[model samples]
Target: MPDIALVLLAGAVAGTMNAIGGGGTFVALPALVAAGLPPVAANAASTVALAPGAVASAWVYRRELAPVGETSVSALTAISVTGGALGAVLLLVLPSASFGAAVPWLLAFATLVLAYGRRVSRALSTATGRSAEARMSSRAVLVAQFLLAVYGGYFGGAIGIMLLAVWSIGLGLDTAASNPMRIAQVSAVNLSATALFLVASDALRTPLVVATMLAGGVAGGIAGAHLARRLPARLLRGTILTIAVTMTVLYFLRGTRAG
Candidate 1:
């Protein structure tokens, strides 16, 4: 009921982040927290509110969906869903203090990956003399993706960036080629988590907040999809990097003060 406009705006930004490159939690979580929800509840609420936006982005990207090496798309989606559901359960079960303490570190790690993921990926490929066509086996990729999905379900500050990093570095995939897969995986992961939260958690009991955010997220996701094709790669990456850095610092500061 309070800061209704701000919540809607934040949701829109969050949706845009999902559409572009991720870090939506950087916006959605804080907005929920400011609205006075506990950290766990805020997180659950954010996942529920932002997932539809991610789904929207995935729809926009349906045409861009590229084949994942050795792994069927259905297999990948199933893995993501299962892992995400497990992770969401863990989030609900874990001690709040433990989650609070981990937030800053998680955000920092994700930001680092988002900031320099490509360079690190390229360097690894070069050191190994890997060819452009090199790819990890299906088994390996599925295992790695499952792990990332768990993390995405539990925290999800920059799941998209981490996925891109894994695909690029481990599979020798091109960034451009992997973007669609990244969106698809994120959509699967978050949607699974959202389904769990909505059914089991009280976070969505606040219907006004949830409704506004969902509407805004849909709008932003659609707009961002259109812009993603037109935006310069460097500029879009820079925008994501900037949001990640800012979020990392704020969450860290909040943790310190709370401690």
Candidate 2:
């Protein structure tokens, strides 16, 4: 009973974070781990538990969805689904040690991008006398999105923040404007990964825990999305940056302890 409550609380907080920016895995994964699941199973379950939250958040932002650069929302979502499924298959078939070791560095790099991406983009545009959007080809943007979707499926930590960072840096898209698409793409990744896990993994072994988390996730996701829509753009960006920095540092510390 106590464990269920804890998991429920964790899911709520995680869902809120995911809707607001993206650091939910930092909360969900550990909560599941502490609830006595093995690490790999816990990771799978965390993804499963959060899948609905991503979808709910995406729904809340459906009206605001926009094309990413030259790519339509449909094309981007397809790419995310494909890459995410592949990543999930890899997770089921291979050892994750090598990939796990690299996660901290990846988060650190993404955080840096989220922090200085627009400023850097502006400076580069001024120097090159070219708009930031003109500097990155559509093909490059698609490739980057695919790669990030793969990462999201394998072990999503701050994938929403990563998407914002990439679009902001590569296309000079405003974070607030890009958020709806970010949530939608994240939904694609999570749904794909969750489908794979449901069929191939033991993520459903604890049905009650999963159900509790799912309910909490849905509630929190809706509330969080509405809350985010009301926040000022500067405040939203600042919140995202703070979460990104905090998650990156925590991941680095975790890696150090593991090492």
Task: Flag clash pairs in model 2.
Answer: none
Worst 10 residues of 1 by lDDT: 168-177
Q: Which candidate leads the pack in TM-score? A: 2
Candidate 2 segments whose C-alpha is farther than 4 A from its true place: none
Tell me the tens digit of each residue's lDDT in model 1 across 127-226.
Answer: 8787433647788889989998998888887788778766765666655556667888999999999989988887787788877888888888888877
Q: Which stretches of candidate 1 lie over 4 Å from their true place?
A: 114-117, 132-135
Candidate 2 lDDT over residue span 1-259, tens digit each: 8999999999999999999999999999988888888888888899999999989999999899989888888889999999889888888888999999898888889889988999999999999999988998888888998999998888888989899999999989888888889999999999999999999998999888888888888888888899999999999999999999999999989989988
Question: What TM-score does candidate 2 reach?
Answer: 0.98
Pick by lDDT: which candidate is best? 2
